[model samples]
Target: MHQCAKEEKVRVIACGAIAREIIAICKANRLGHIDLQCLPAIWHAYPEKITPGVENAIAEARAEGIERIFVGYADCGTGGLLDALCAREGVQRIEGPHCYSFFAGNAAFAENDDDVTSFFLTDFLARQFAAFVIEPLGLDRHPQLKPMYFGNYRKLVYLSQLEDENLKRKAKEAADYLGLEYEYRFTGYGDLTSALTRL
Candidate 1:
């Protein structure tokens, strides 16, 4: 994807925990090297704030003449960080609404389908739900079994998961907060499955 982006004259710089993975994928496809770096701890914790270490990552990439940067990890994990870094460095950052969803369009991902649920089979998607869905819903709705609607269902993926004891607590809290419909299903990665299944 980066290569395609670059071939189209898109300047590309990559940062994230999976920087190595991006590097491997790019190299395997003979994508030319730009600049790559593992995310710093500060970037992960308080993404809005870039410490000296985080600055170093940007500097290293810049030194390689990378004109633009794209943080390659899931949005939940790196979105905040990307936002902060872009603000702090005055450098542009490109990320998707969600990381898994972003890859669906990238040629680097070789799936026949752009189904979001397919990511649930990956630990990557599991982590994304834990942050984006589980956490926010917990703070808001308290995690009750409920139906969720997006943009009037223009494109939606629906799947259900049985709540674990812990998920039950969060679900109850989410129910009170978000007030969306929820149902008991047999899987844990509901958010990804739902959106992807619909696609």
Candidate 2:
């Protein structure tokens, strides 16, 4: 962020679960006058209204006299937030892809290998999900659960965390029978970056 600020002469505004980590980095580097926009985890569960969330965040950023706002994370819940915010606030948003990919692609320290990138990304996501569940939600680490096999992929079967326990149990059974491996996998940002380069 400090490097970008020096080059672009603008402030960096970040959002998502990793915002605090970015803040720590900025503070450690003595980067001042940064406008950070922190949003709720609710958007992760429900990604539909993320446009409004971005709008609200942008409004807050503008109020802070930030000349430019750059979103470092743009995936999962915060994927569309930057676009919505750009449209609403009429500020140009830079093309920073998913968090991992962006970092991996822009990494100047080393010549990244494709295999190494893939391994790191996968591990990173797993660690991230594990941390979120364990630290925030207080969830227990049970056996590695597989997604229940449900044959009717054609049918519009909704699988939400809000579903009743009975329905969830049934879905799980179906997924397991179907051999669905829906376990969260850590994907390194470098993997995404390399994939994009291939394209």
Candidate 3:
């Protein structure tokens, strides 16, 4: 974690999953008064660690005398632990169940039945598929785990935030590897734009 510059008025502790997109949003809107500190994107695979990691970040920010803070995560996989932390700290987080939900627009994503069968990915996951999915899950060595882990998933939906052809191709490859149908949607940061801009 990085220290917030004293000039910064607000600190947004974020998941590294959306770190790049947050930087893009802040840059595009000239939100230079905000400081971003991120936990490892790899933590997305470990929901249990999220709450404590965020709690530490909040303490660090408070130590630096920054009172205006926002958490750039959804409920994520923390059950309600992250929300409880935010409430106790008196801070607000991006409203959504997860990055995929916010990237697709919360209500619209909820209304879609395809989500029940769709495994989701964003640009970050597409780029780090092997590091995050394959090796960590042992899918690289135990290919059989694929069926056991993904048995219920029917499709891999890539909610893209950019028009990068390379990332799209990588996402398609991941879908093929998992034996899931591939669908691409150009979401372009969805609700994240509005949320960060409000900072």
Candidate 4:
């Protein structure tokens, strides 16, 4: 088992997608006792890279003498590998299948079975839709591929972490581009706040 650090402060190794929200939460709560580190947001599309990346970050932090570390990722499509790594390393992570569940509050998200046909986008994703979703999915290169990719998705749900009208507009446009209905949910960091407070 890993030992706790003598220092009272803790480090949070986060997914780059939620880095801004994590920082905002820390600043708003005056959680100077915690530090934050993040891997690339693009890794959201590449689940295979997440485990090693998080492991490397943890090792780096431990080498810096920070024995207390909290992973900011949920299972995040790692097929429980991320959880397994955390278990072996003796570090705790936010509880949920992914960021969407955590941001919407795990219990509420679990109860919302109507969202199974939904495609989700957070603020960061809304901003990077073109780069991350459109281009990467080849929708920009081949418009005919849109239906193939989004055929099963009936709606695009924009889970807003902050009240940004521009991002909402962008999310709506993304839904339009994907030929899906649009929805907006203002979650405001939901359980992320509580998780950080626990640190």
lDDT of predicted model 1: 0.40
In candidate 3, stretches whose alpha carbon ends up further than 4 angstroms from where it belongs are 1-8
| Candidates by lDDT, descending order | 3, 4, 2, 1
Estimated TM-score for each candidate: 0.36, 0.46, 0.96, 0.95
Better of 2 and 3 by lDDT: 3
What tens digits encode model 2's per-residue C-alpha lDDT throughout 1-199?
2231333233444445445445555555545544455565435445665566666666766676666665444554455655766666666543444444344343431343422212121222232444432233333433333222123232212212222445444444433433443322222233323322221
Q: Model 3: per-residue lDDT, tens digit, 52-131?
A: 99999999989989889999999999999999999999999999999999999998899998689999999999999999
* Best first by TM-score, ranked: 3, 4, 2, 1
Backbone clashes for every candidate come to 26, 18, 0, 0
The weakest ten consecutive residues by lDDT in model 2 span: 154-163
Any residue pairs clashing in model 4, and if so which?
none
Evaluate residue 131 in candidate 4 and report its C-alpha lDDT on the 0 to 100 scale.
86
Q: What is the lDDT of candidate 2?
A: 0.42
Show model 4 residue runs off by greater than 4 Å: 1-7
Q: What TM-score quantifies how close candidate 1 is to the native fold?
A: 0.36
Winning candidate number (TM-score) = 3
RMSD to truth, every model: 11.4, 11.7, 1.7, 3.6
